[model samples]
Target: MEPFALTVALPIFGLIALFCLPSRIANRRAKLVRNLVTTVVGVECLFALSLTVGLAVKGVPSQSIKLIEVWRDLGLNLDVFVDGAASLMLMLVSFVGFVVSRFSIRFLDGERLQGRYFRWLGFTIGAVSLMVVAGNLLLFFLAWVATSFGLHQLLLHYRHRAAAHRAAWTKFAISRFGDALLIGALALTYYAFGTFELTELFSRARDLATSASQVTASHVAIGWLLVLGAVTKSAQFPFHTWLPDTMETPTPVSALMHAGIVNAGGYLIIRMSPLVALAPTAMISLAVIGAFTACFAGVVMMTQTSVKRSLAYSTIAQMGFMMLQCGCGAFSAAMLHILAHSLYKAHAFLGSGSVVSQALATTGAKSPQPSPHLSLAYLLGAAAISAFAYAAVSSAFDVNVVTKPGGVILALVVCLALTTWGWRLLSVGEITTMLLGMTGISGLCLAYTASYLAVSHWLQATTPLFAIPPTPRFVLLAIALAFCALFWLHFVVIRRVRPNWLNSLRVHAANGFYIDTVYRRLLTPLARS
Candidate 1:
């Protein structure tokens, strides 16, 4: 079998088999079910790994293989496009699917919906896998719809739960809106370029961008439509409330959704980088909305009492950050962020049960505050260390990817990381332990930066570096500074009791700034009346 067909078809066949098995058979043969899922997903992961490794060794091959042809005159075909970004996403989906499937073997043991759960789980994985590899817009849309339908089933697994049903419906509503935008985008692409193939569209897009005067209304409309779809898919701003409510779903489903499905927006933006680079208006909109959502969700995350809810908000903020990277024309950084966030969020969701115990352990523990002079020293130390580390890593890796918004935003994140470590060390009473912790944190940060840069370098083909516009540059910097300030404030609010004014803000934050209330109020009356 061809590599693409093998990778895409295996999971699909697995899904079919899972669906065919009767619930009683799956329940009675639980071990067999576990083995089947593990083997199928594990093989998919291996196939993805092989493809990725081949890319590294072969130096970014332009490999496209058609799986099937759906139309002749329209030029629509089910083709697989294998690039660094696609490879990374495939590996991520497969590995996460395998891990979540294995985990669910025990996590959801004896649940009545075990067979049904596996069926949807398998279907979602297969659908997502196909979506990432799609070479034609038609196939991409089909896979996209499949994932949405499968996810809705998974979200409403507990059919009797009102909250779950409500959350599912909200998600479904948002998804349809996004789908409409995507369909419009596809239609525009076909109208403009006369083909649904990515390679053809990208070639024409390059020509259009080069002849800046040739760019037209359709180009701008298509770009905005794609971004709008991505914004809804990633759950930014107004669409974000549904994500937090989705905690009513199963843990594995939450992991898959947050870790894999939610990253679809970033993936879409990156995959269409050629076209996105041409639309300054769309990019600016992405930056503005993404920045606000990141800050908003970050603040709200701090006030969330429930661990799962906090994680949900955290995903929103991370997705916003990813979108911000895209807006900055930091597609490579966005890809890295997607990969890192997926792994981190998956682990966080799967192990969320231990959060209560961890919280209990830290309940009465007092953190030591440094004197003014000492605090100043720590802050200076953190800034110096972070700057030095960033410079060294960038220089060593030859990552001259220091473009406007992405570079500054990345620096802010580094500053936050080092400063948080500095605070932690200040609370440590032992000098030796503090020094050791500082050294360890610095080293880990260096390693992470280097690895990210290396991956960014490899994925450069899929995401060509682009520069942000002048006005958006200033706006992005402001957003970056706001996030840094918000980060510091979050640290403060979490460690101390809030005052009266701050308590009001906390209530607002806890209620997600009343956005959901407004949504319900506006929609509910229309439904009833």
Candidate 2:
């Protein structure tokens, strides 16, 4: 067996063994199962480590390695092909799985559901392992679906806890919605290009010999749809709210999803980047959404009280940053951040549980808030992101990047100065200052999105056919100056919005639109009928 196959196969085998083992021996059974699980997971981790070593030594050597046949005559097969990105993700998944398993041992000490829990856990690992290495889109899709199933089960691991059960189903339902979108995209992929091989599809997509299903189904359309698949899976933008709420699952599950599987979306974008490049709109969309989501989630994190929820929001924000990197053509750097953050985030969540567990074990009840220094540190860290986003976007201010030197700088100063100053005001109970900070953050989000869209279009030199003709430079300058006036006018609205502005923003934010409400209104009665 190929080295990669060993990594993928071990998890499958472990899950099989876990489920097959009888559940009646009490402590004797748990201990035996624990030992066996440790051994299997340990072996899996080694295989991943070996692949990583091999990659580092030899650098992403791809070979055609057959793993299974999902179909016979229809040209469907499960092939695991190793690339630099896939190897890295597998290592991350396996490493996290090892840690979570170790934690599970101590945390789940006498839990009767250990067998089922490990089974789902192993299955999730197996699916993600296959997913990251899948050479074909169909195989990748299968693994994607399998990964979702594992997540669904993992979320429901504490079936007795209604919140746990509810979170599991919520995750399942949201994931299913994405699944439908992905299935459609896969169908379109196959229909557009006859073969499901992801590599071949990208190679042929630019010069399609096949007819499109619709005249309007151009390169941009397919790219947009595929990106929709990516965003939904990766949990970008509008697709994001689901991820933050998913913390109802055990902390371990959150770690795995955010640190490992969430990055899968990024991996997909990178793997299919060639095809994505052909669809500039998709890239730009990602850039804009990623930018806003990163900033939005990061800011929201500051408001959160739950430690896990804070991390969850942080994951959302960071994922947006990764997407922005991808949009801006800084893939290698994005991968580095993903790698570093995965370790840190997993450690943070696991450590949190350990702290909570220890606290309860000793003095009982909830632990106190983090020191004021820590709180201030988090706020300052958030304020500084306006600068980081500014810097990252500033490095290559293309149309594809969402941050403009001007816009990003403005947002940065406005957000940081306002937020920091607002903190001072809030310290002295200045509601006006607090509201100003709130409005500043909101404005920054919109500005970030606009920058994202412009950058995306810039990357591919996409010009809107209906765009207004450009005026003379001096004429444009006059308009630009006029816009400066308009910007302040908008700021004035933000200024006057008052202390209770968040309450109004809440209505917009809560309904997640009036957009969500509109969507519900449109979809709800139709579904009921």
Candidate 3:
């Protein structure tokens, strides 16, 4: 088998091996099960690393291999495809799997269902790995559903806890709804293109793009269906009630769900960017919805008192931002976001307990309150410095921030983030601190620009270069203004200004605007039946 083929096959086989472990061995030899699962995951990680290195050296654009012919007539075949996006996702999932498995061994020690936990964990990881590398829509759909089911089991590890059961059931319901949407999208895709194979579909889509052929209603439907599916899976607003409520699950399960599973929605959009971009309406919808979710979740995250709940909302906000990047046709940035967010969320989830303990141990200090004049000056200075730094780094890297898709807005977003950091640092009122903070911000800007350039290069072959949307300048200006307002509001809240309306808003934000309550009320009758 080719190296790429072997890498894809390993996960499926590992999943089988895990399920085939005897009940007696699993129940009695927990340590052995732990070692076996860890070793398998570790080896998978190594394979992913080697695959990435190999691809880099050879510069192979993309490769598709049929692993099994389940039913040719029905377009149901097991296939594996590798490209920049797949390779990146594979490496991320494998590394996170290995780490989480190792962590679980210690965390779940002496638990009665330790062996069962390892089995499901391995299955979930394998399923996700396979999903990322799937070559055909059918294979991808199967793996997607399999991952959900496997995770469902893992979420129910504490079967006796009613809250765990409720969360799991809620997730299951949402996932099934997503599955339906995906199925509709896949069917429409086959109807329009007459192929489930990704390579052929992409080729045909590109042909449509290059030709004067108008997009049909089926194409538009496929795009809408896909966006709906992705939003549900990624816990976008109105369907995100399950995530924060899932704190009853084991920590490892939470880690995997946030770090790996939640990213599936963004991955789907990136993988199918060629087709999805055909519908401007869909793309615009994604941007609007994603922007709303991010803003909504960001505010809610700030008001969360529980550490885990806070992280849960943070994941929602990050996923929303990622989706927004995709909707803006910034596929490369979206992919980069996935990779960075995955690593950060994994660590955040795994170390959440330690984080809470440390927070309690440390005494909180009031932030220094500089005079209003000095504060305004510092803010303005930070904004200027951030913009200059970003522009310089982008120019150094030979990147045209203005011409790229969603370039201007994303660049400004980065600048805004840096400005916030700088402003906070400057407020510290120490020369040494200001110098160090500026240095750190400079390094971060350089690193971010470099990473974005590299990701764009890697995805050049696989992803389509989307044309800038209509009224790009207008869109950029509007978004920039909105972000500035948000930043101002953040400071106002922090300083406890306008306690009357602000307190009311905080209550609404903390309750997620009662969206989840409405969902539960609507579903109560059906759930009872």
Best by TM-score: 3
Off by over 4 Å in 1: 1-8, 13-34, 359-367, 371-373, 400-405, 465-471, 494-497, 522-529
| TM-score against native, each model | 0.92, 0.67, 0.95
Error of 1 at 298 (Å): 0.5
lDDT per residue, candidate 2, 427-483, as tens digits? 433467546654555455456545454333322211111111122235324433443
| lDDT tens digits by residue: candidate 1, 285-349 | 89788888998999999888898999999999999989988887777778888988999999999
lDDT of 3: 0.85
State the lDDT at 458 in candidate 3.
Answer: 89
lDDT of 2: 0.62
**Whole-model Cα lDDT per candidate?**
0.80, 0.62, 0.85
- How close to the true structure is residue 142 of candidate 2, measured as C-alpha lDDT? 81
Q: What is the lDDT of candidate 1?
A: 0.80
lDDT: which candidate is best? Answer: 3
Lowest summed lDDT over 10 consecutive residues: which window, candidate 1?
464-473
- In angstroms, the error of model 3 at 374 is 2.1
lDDT of 1 at 95: 94
